[model samples]
Target chain A: MTKKLMKGSEAIGEAAVQAGCHLFFGYPITPQNEIPEYMSMRLPQVGGTFVQAESEVAASNMLYGAAGSGERVMTSSSSPGISLMAEAISYLAGAELPVVIVNIMRGGPGLGGILPSQSDYFQATKGTAHGDFRLLVLAPWSVQEAANLVQDAFDLADYYRNPVLILGDGLIGQMMEPVEFADSREPIKVLPPKTWAATGHNGSKPRSVINSLFLDPEELERHNFHLKEKYDRMERDEVRYEAHGLDTDYDVLIVAYGTVARVCLTALEELAEEGVKVAMVRPVSLFPYPSAAVREAAAGAKAVLVVELSMGQMIEDVRLAVGRSKPIHFLNRVGGMLISPDAVIDKIRAIEDGSSEEVRHA
Target chain B: MLETVFSRPDALRDVTTHYCPGCTHGTIHRLIAEVLDELGVRERTVGVAPVGCAVLAYNYFETDFHEASHGRAPAVATGIKRARPDLVVFAYQGDGDLASIGMAEIVHCANRGEKVTVVFVNNAIYGMTGGQMAPTTMPGQVATTCPLGRDVDMAGHPIRVSEMLSTLRTPAFVARASVHTPLLAVNAKEMLRRAFSYQVAGRCFSLVEILSTCPTNWGIPPAEATTWLEKNMLPYYPLGVFKTPERGSREPLPLEG
Candidate 1:
């Protein structure tokens, strides 16, 4: 199948429709409104459902209700909207319902400006809701990757019976690239048996209920324990990462993901020309973190430099992976701005030699 | 031989409900089940349970039911209905759930004219959370939170959701009735049946707000509770149908125009 050029957000919408996701619930917000708009046009054509929900809270809850009824459902929003959706996400996670969420991150401590930023890193992986649960978070760097990951997100959500998050940024969302829709196959319907779906007890045994209530402490503990077991199995089988130039004997390594990783790769190539040996490790699954891979790479490097478009959130994960094995440094820019490749190289070089005092014009 | 005292509408769950004695939640639950049985939609309907005292309603409702957090039933119901429009869908919510935290969701759903039914049970006090003041609490009503009597100056006036929602032209049907007495209970049932009929007719946003009693929370006997609902709450939240679209209407009326 030949590929056609497509924007990241457009790819997500197309992939969702092709995957037999009949419902798309979302609210219009900057950086990710394209997904909702695309769905509004396409879903109707396919005889599916598309709704600009009243708010993020309603949208996420809508996803919950749809998923509970044994249908494929999804929602998309940016950072602030995702924050509002946290409560519903937690309920979905608690109930162990399968659903997909797309977070087109923008800069924020409050209502940060709508620009591409990896600032929602912690929030996606950790802040879904106040609970012992993790959303399967996928960080896609390129537009094509973002599109492809939506299909993968649906698969993972169904496979694990949990919420999956496609974490990207505004640039990836807005950037147009080659994407072949003709190459995409019809969705493989691998839905689990509806033993627990709320599809009414017609001819079957009384009825199957979907809920997250545990009145007894012991019962709740058991529920959490089961969820943890599932998570542990996933951690073993689903850890994904990409190593670039790591085999080469490098004095420093750069760790990043999503758009930041793309910028770090460009900067690393520049550092190589200057005779400063550098490598990079990009995590595709942020929740899984690719910790073992990073730790193995860190063992041989003198220092690891982490660069991101946030106030050093993912860097903490890097620190956990390294753990005194090597010195960990951070280069960050906050409030919805991208960190340039030059700044990353400068940081890496400074850490390598301990002589340079912040390279200029990065 | 024991005659069939239990309705055929009910699923064979022998466990008695956990509702307070003399509360109307059980009556409403039975009514919904009976309607589902009458229409043969029980096999193809999904019900959403909201917070308040009915949080565990999935236990009583034999159909495919999902429980939502406080006030989020409308959104959840929207999801289910949109995902499976062929199936019957309704959300059962109380005063605190539908009138308080979920006010935005209810209003927006009604305004957008979603093709679904809402069975709103309006008991003047918050039943689940230990009798706190609800958005529909009548003036001078005393509860755990408003122990000094509901002061309109301190706690705002009661919200008449039926009237407010009826003003929106998008909804195909909006009505309010009470179940405080046998005669009124019959009216509430008919109102509920009409709301669900609108959904069956594919009309958008049908709602029936039933004035229910919380004798336990209201600190009154069942007789007094019935009398108070008729004398006080009914006057504030008058009972009647607000709007009714034609049987086959599909076009949504613009709320603004």
Candidate 2:
């Protein structure tokens, strides 16, 4: 009913609870610990369960189990912890189970740092374990957006019978923001019944088996195609992005997401004061990546600038989307380094001055 | 009219299993099916099958099933039991799956006193992976990995999982049984029944570690595999109750000969 100022991680947990997600399985990792901590305190009051699993490996499997039984379940962790969950993620994808996973990204090749980084963009969108399957990835730029997307993640997961990942960074996890959950607790969409759940037949129906193993090669190929169809549908129907300054003439189009996108918005305001028109496209869904939107936005701009917390991961997608139609530039801060608005303004100014080469290697 | 007796358990399907000849997995499956039928929980039971020789265990059971990754069956079962406390849940795992890769999941599940049943089959070797050494592999016993007899100096000593778990502070039903012989097979069924009964009553975590035989992996004839288990394996892994709610003390029951 009333807006509550909450930490991003806590808001994500509350949003899940409001969405009727009663079961949470998680292992402690920096930056995202608030999620499980909040769940442990809040779930029991709502007659739900929160299990602090031994490791990320076990926590993800617990999700597989709970989801197999037709319950709305979720888990959250940071970068390395997410890596540990890769195997189970593949299994969940293969099994076509509906579960929500949140990754409050820190830095990494290993246990990098506890500060914000978007290095896991590729991990979330591309190689999330060995699979021909894909997880519907949603990237939220603010705490309120993170809360809203976590709730949407449940519905999207159920709608497609696939795992949906809420990809946030450490900043989004730690930053406090006012989030308004709907007063009337109703799901955003009506979902199909989980008739395939392994909740015991009770002799009235046939037994249900939740499995991903396909020994027959032909059967496995067909299963892969079946999953491909779901992902294809996601790409067609679930593409979401926010385009700013697109209605007016702009020279530079910035492609960014999550926290970096917010940073770019501030840089956009400063650049506009300097008479440099900079339009931006912030992708909301990372997997069904607003490719067409990026292309359409890039068509009107002289050059495209891709910003991220990682070196150059999402830039690959941007390049694919724009495809040499215009000169594309890259800017980033890695290993827990935050990209300041001044740095972004400098890059935009350099691009406008045709001195982009000076900052290209910067 | 002719009297009918000893038909297949209602909880077991009629399809043939992929197990090699003389593998005791079939016996253990039957024992579990019988227990589910006897307790009248067949309709409300969800079984989590591990990734080993019993990877296709879901197909053998008539109840609802979930196939879990290697060593994650306990975690999976914990999810199911916690989500729907009304349903009966169990995880069937093997030596490599439970005692090695899944060691942390099993120990924590037991320590937390999760209300679920675990059927651990310890054949002392990895069957599906082609006779590799396992965490419970007996000392001086040869495996494909340990070609020249397992040198305890090189490989660590075998883990007595039931005994180790019995020392945990939480209340649970932990026991070691065998299905190498008919007498032991009957005892194993009772032990399995007790394990499931504990979960049915929502008592605590329960695990029945059944010492099984892998004739194909052991490089022995099926009949001689039982003799090998009795003569060699039994001494190290004795059959007995390791922990029970009635027995408050942490000490295990006396080792059976």
Candidate 3:
């Protein structure tokens, strides 16, 4: 298939169509409105339904209902919008329904700025809602990867019968890049039968119930443990990452994901030109978070830099991965800001000269 | 052996219920089951259960079920019905679940004219949380939270769900009925049947609000709760059909494109 220039949000919407997703329920939010915009024009052309829900919470419940009826469905929102969806997301996970959600995150703890920021790292990777549940989170570093991972998201969600998240920032959603969708005629992977779908009962098929409530304490415990097992398996088999310039023994290792990783890649070239050795590990999956790969990439490095678009949220995860062997550094550009390569190079020089104290406090 | 003059509806599973004594939730459930069974739509019907007293509605219904979040059952039912138009879908919700937190969901769903049915049970008070105030709680009605009686000035007037729904230009059917007496229960059942019938005919949105008695929460006997529902609740929330479109109706609804 020929590639076409598209905004990241538009590309993600087309990718959902290619993946045979036919239902979309979403509320309009900044930096991600293009997704619902694109879907509204495209889904109806293909005999699918695109409902602009009354609220993000309602949209997520619509996703839950569509997924419960054995259909590939998706919803997209920004940060505060996603906060409203947290309850329904937890319900989807607890019900063991397969659905895909995309977070084109913006800045915030409240109604933060509408510009690009990765401040939602903790919310997406950690305690999302009131339950012992995990969403298989995928991070896309580029527009093309955004399209590819979205297709994978639907397949994986159906395969595991669990919710999947594609976590991007406002930068990814707003940026324009060339993206090629898979040919629509190309056959998709055959998934296991969703025998539990509440589709309807003919005489041949028994009635199905999609429920998350367990009044019995023991039964609820068992259900929770079963979910734990699924997450454990995802952690083992779904972890993915990319290593750049790791072969040559590097003086500093930079760990990042999503848009920050792309910026860090450019910074790596700048640092090398200045007679400094730097490598990077960009995690592709944030939940089953390529921890082992990060540790290996950080091996024998004198120092490490955890760069993000937030106020040092992902730094803790990198700290857990690399441990106390080396001094870990954090570089961030928060509140709808981006870090430049020159600033990154300055941080690398400071850390190398053992002026890490000044940079850390900065 | 006694003659089997009455038998349990095929759509209702034969099991003991968890409802408190004198609670009319069981009666409403039976009405829904009977309607679906009589319509011969049991096989293709899917019910969306609410988060209040009827939270376990999925357990009593024999067909497909989806348990929605608090007040989000209408949205859930919209998703299910739109995806599989061949199936009959209805959302079962209580007063607090539908009229309070779910108010936005139900109103938008009705305005969109989604082809689905809503079986709403309004008992004038929250049942599951030990009877706090609900959106449908009447003026001067007393509950655990509204210990001083519902002040019209402070709490605002109780919402008339059926009347409010009928004001929308989209929904095909909107009715308010009570199950206080056997005759009234039969009347509520006919309204339910009509609502479900609209869904079966692929009509627009339909909702039936059934005024029920919550004896435990009302601080009265089951029989007195029935009379109280008739005397106190019925005057405020009149029991009648607010709107009914021509049968098998369909029209374009604004989806906020």
Q: What proportion of the real contacts between chains A and B does each prediction keep?
A: 0.85, 0.87, 0.83
DockQ metric, candidate 2: 0.89
Total clashes in model 2, counting residue pairs 3 or more apart in sequence or in different chains:
0
Model 3 quality (TM-score): 0.96
Global fold similarity of model 2 (TM-score): 0.98
Estimated TM-score for each candidate: 0.94, 0.98, 0.96
Question: Which candidate ranks first by lDDT, i.e. highest?
Answer: 2
Candidate that would win on TM-score: 2
lDDT of 3: 0.89
- Residue ranges of candidate 1 with Cα displaced over 4 Å: A181-191, A356-362, B1-8, B247-257
Minimal lDDT window, size 10, model 1 chain A? A353-362
User: Which model scores highest in DockQ?
Assistant: 2
Query: For residues A1-362, could you state the per-residue lDDT of candidate 2 as single tens digits?
Result: 78999999899999999989999999999989999999999999999999999999999999999999999999999999999999999999999999999999999989899999999999999999987889999999988899889999999999999999999998999999898988875666688888999999677777899999999999999999999999999999999899999999999999999989999999998888888899999999999999999999999999999999998999989888988788999899998999999999999989988888622321
Better of 2 and 3 by DockQ: 2
For model 2, state the Cα shift of residue B176 in Å: 1.1
lDDT of 3 by residue, A1-362 (tens): 89899999999999998889989999999989999999999999999999999999999999999999999999999999999999999999999999999999999879989999998888898978989999999999899999999999998899888999999998889899998875654433468788899977665777788989998999999999999999999998888889999988899999999988888889899888877899999999999988898888888587888999998787888888878866788889989988888888888888888877522322
